[model samples]
Target: MRRFDSAQPILAGLVSAVVGYASSFTVVLAGLRAVGATPAQAASGLLALCAGIAATAVFLALRFRMPISIAWSTPGAALLVATGHVQGGWPAAVGAFLVCAALIVVAGLSPWLGRAIAAIPRPIAGAMLAGVILSLCTAPVRAVVDVPALAIPVVLAWAVLTRFARQWAVPGALLAAVVAIAVRGVHLTGVSIAPAAVLTVPTFNLPALISIAVPLFLVTMAAQNVPGMAVMATYGYTPPLRGVLVTTGLASAFAAPFGGHALNLAAITAALTAGPDTHPDPRRRWVATAALGAGQLTLGLGAGLAMALVLLSPPVLVIAVAGLALLSALGASLASAVTDPSGREAAVVTFVVTASGTTILNIGPAFWGLVAGGLTALLLYRRTRPSSPPDPTPPSPAATELPSPTAAGPAASR
Candidate 1:
């Protein structure tokens, strides 16, 4: 009983890592490919991400004695898929990754930059993210229309499991995709199962920086890091903002040469390890994140095999799985996008431009979406003066106090 009790947090950590990796790895691979990485490079990118996640999670958990879960930026991957190939191809994209990493570090050191990011209204940020992922979210329906025989089984598996076992739905869909590939008689020949890292010398170009780096930075910060902090805070943990930003930014920089795009705080999966469900005592929760690091290291060893399976399968089927995985994120983004009446028009404009996949002056629609939305808000949104003077009464202590954990509600799913 003692041994089993001690192992609970470890098991929770492992579960969190598995769920995080399985749910969105296809998106990572697809994003790498979209940015012109070859099969080998994409596999390398996956391996690099796994290594970074493992190293950073373990280091932070141990250093802070807190459950600080780290993850590859899923929405950033979706943004990559939307942006497609850019100038200087994979190398340029890599350069953008490094540039974004520097920006993250700068944001940590410079309060002004951090404030600038925070100044972007939540609705606008949410709308931009919604636009970025809209196309990829539609891939499932397109897959069914284009390849029903393979796509239908995957969709049905995801749907059924989503209704009954939401956490396992994406993994179940991936399993269905694998079975479909086998049934289709697709043979994997000359596939390398050993993980290997291939480094590409990054080339900086204006187009990739504007198109990929800025949007990727915004999505990572708004969608992942900020919410991750809130999730931890909800559970009564205060992670050091500067340390986390610098650590993850450095990790991302180290992995960029190997094709990994970005790494940030884990929002959705943070609950698994940070909440009391992982362990009755909050002090022991860090052990669970350390176990998560071990699990990610184990998964990193199989990156080559995972890449091989993805490469051998029908593209649409894999895409269908990626689409299903992102459905929840899309729903949450859309909800946040239109929640404020004042920002509704700007958010809608952002979403439409992003979804349209337009490119002007060799820059992707995501950057343009922000520009259009900001302009729309500037021209249309006007603050009216109050009809009377403001009240001067001070708030009660209870009103100023933070909510209890039970009342904090669940963190936004990434």
Candidate 2:
């Protein structure tokens, strides 16, 4: 018997995995390299991330009996890319990764921490995410300007595909990019096919912990996990927040020694599996998420191949494809951040400061963006707001005046 009566769910799952993987793996690779991972180690890290998230997604879906999709922290990867070289190199980065995982675990176990994270204003969160992805979203334009011949076809393909099959746009663009790269005779020489797990003995560094781990944890929670829960809620499936957090945290820790930075609830791809289009019956959508996990696992096994393929491409091409993938996410975040008049200024401030790439006291722009936005919002809104009376509770039926039953009785009428 088929696990799911409808194949739509299964198909949706497969597509989610493909789109998710193809979209952001380059960013992961670039981030790992920036943090001092050798090419071989970076490949191992990518594989470990895929495997860890795959396992986490499967476990969470089965445990919760919901379509809870898990994903690597793309925003966190972008953070790492922005941070570049740290004080202790890759070993220190590994230590920071472990710290991030531990923090996530604590957030899961401690109600106070979870509440604190949840208390973050939605506008600030959206703006911070938008800022983080701003650079990435510009890659398409830069790539086109830098290499028109290679980028134009990919962009055109994405535009055409998006018009028809919106879901397949990114992957379609990626296919076009691959063809463009191949036609240009990009050499594949010197690319290694061997997939080896390179373990880094983590070295504790306070600077790395403060800079990388703190920002990573914040971004993963605010940008990915929080919105991920919203996505699930949209489909009326509310999985336990703690369980999801703990599962992804442990997975991130497990993969850290081999190069993975962080894993969390997936926001973008979750829609593919959780939406009504996946299946008419929401109860059976877990099968689609499971299929997604299986697909991710299969791709994880081919991490070496993925690494080789990426290595063969020019950096511009890789980033351009990645930019195309993130355009939708960027647009959505911007729209959401400024949708409300109350928070518009704060959100814009957050977006500008974060996108500015400013670092203060060794902390990155993302952290500062949230702080500035929150403070600005508090100050701005408090000054202009008028005092209002508290709403009164409604009267109970027994307390309210009503027509007496005796007055309407048949005996009285007679």
The best candidate in terms of lDDT: 1
Model 2 lDDT per residue over 47-146, tens place: 8998897798788778878999999998888888777778889999999999999999999999999877766666677888788878878888988999
lDDT tens digits, residues 40-69, model 1? 999999999999999999999999999999
Off by over 4 Å in 1: 382-414
lDDT of 2 at 123: 69
Runs of candidate 2 exceeding 4 Å displacement: 1-8, 378-414
Clashes of 1: 0
CA lDDT of 176 in candidate 2? 89
The clash count for each model shown is 0, 0
